[model samples]
Target: MTRHLIPLLVFVVIVGFLWAGLSLNPREVPSPLIGKPAPEFALPQLRDGGNIVRAADLRGQVWLLNVFASWCTPCLEEHPYLVDLTRRNLVPVYGLNYKDQRSAALEWLGRHGDPYAGIVVDAEGRTGIEYGVYGVPETFVIDKLGVIRFKHIGPLTPHILNEEILPLVRKLQT
Candidate 1:
C-alpha cells in the first residue's frame, strides 16, 4: 500500500509542475507588452548604407516590432502580409532579422517586398534576448508613450490581425 501511494503522489507532483509551467508561460508573452515601455535595441542593418535603427526612434507613435529570420520557414509564410500591412499604411512595421547572413537577409528582403520601414540585424540573437523572444516571428505593438501594448506570438494571420491587432491599434490611436 505504501509503495503504491508513493508512486501516485509522485505522479501528481509531476502533473502539477507541468500545469504550472504552461500556465506561467503566457501564450502571447509579456502580456502583449501592455502598459510597459517598449524595449530598447540598436543593431546595424544588413542592407547597404550602414544605417542602424533603434527602438527609441518609435516614440510618440504606435508601431509594430516584428521579429523574424530568413532561416525560419514560418517567417516566409508571413512576409507578404507584413508587406500588405505596409502598403495599407495601417501602422508602422519595423523588423528584427535574427541571426542570419547579411547576403541572405538582404536577398530575402529584396525578393519579398521590403515591408519594414527599418530593419535591425540581430545576428547573434542578442536583441531578441533583450526582448524576451523565445522563437521567430513574435510581434510587439508599441504605444505612443513607448510602452508595449501587445505581443503576438507565432505567425501573423489575417484572423489575428482583424480580431486582435487592428482593434488594439484603433484603441491606441484614440
Candidate 2:
C-alpha cells in the first residue's frame, strides 16, 4: 500500500509544479539585467554600414532599445505603436536589428515606418545574446545612466505603453 502511494504522491507533486508554471505570466519573465548596466556594444548602423552606434554613446538619456528582426511577425504588430512613440518624442527609441539582413530590415522599415532614432545591425545576434534577448520583439528600458530598468518580452500594445512603459520612462527621466 505504501509503495502504491509513492507514485500518487509524485504525480501530485508534478501536477502542482505544472499548475504553478501555467499560472505564471510569460511576459513578466524577470530579467537579470534589470537595474544592471546594459551590455556594451558597437554595432554598424543598419542603413549606413559605415556608421557605428555604440551603447555607451546613448548614456545620459533614457531610451528604449527595441530588439527586432525583419522576419518576426510579432514585431509587425508592435511596429505601429513604436512609430507612434517615436512621433511623440517622449524618449529616444533605438533599434537593435537582431540576426537579420540589412536589406530586409531596411525594406521592412520602409514599408512599415522607420520609428527608430538610430538602428544598429546585429547580423550574428551576438549583441542580442549579450542583451539577454530570448527572441526578437524584446524591448529594454535603459535609464539615463545606461542601466537597464525594465524589459518587455513581447509585443508592445497601447495598454502596456500607457500603463507600464511610459510611466517608467517618465519616472526615470526625472
Give the TM-scores of the predictions, in the order they appear.
0.80, 0.87
- Per-residue lDDT of candidate 2, residues 2-71 (tens digit): 9999999999999999999999987666889999999999999998999998999999999999999999
Best by TM-score: 2
The C-alpha stretches of model 2 lying farther than 4 A from their native spots are 1-21, 26-28
Per-residue alpha-carbon lDDT of model 1 for 8-36, expressed as tens digits? Answer: 99999999999898877556445534677
* Clashes per candidate (backbone, < 3 Å): 3, 0
Clashing pairs in model 1, backbone N/Cα/C closer than 3 A: 32-150, 32-151, 33-148
Local distance difference test values of all predictions, in order: 0.84, 0.94
lDDT, model 2 = 0.94
Model 1 Cα shift for residue 173 (angstroms): 1.8
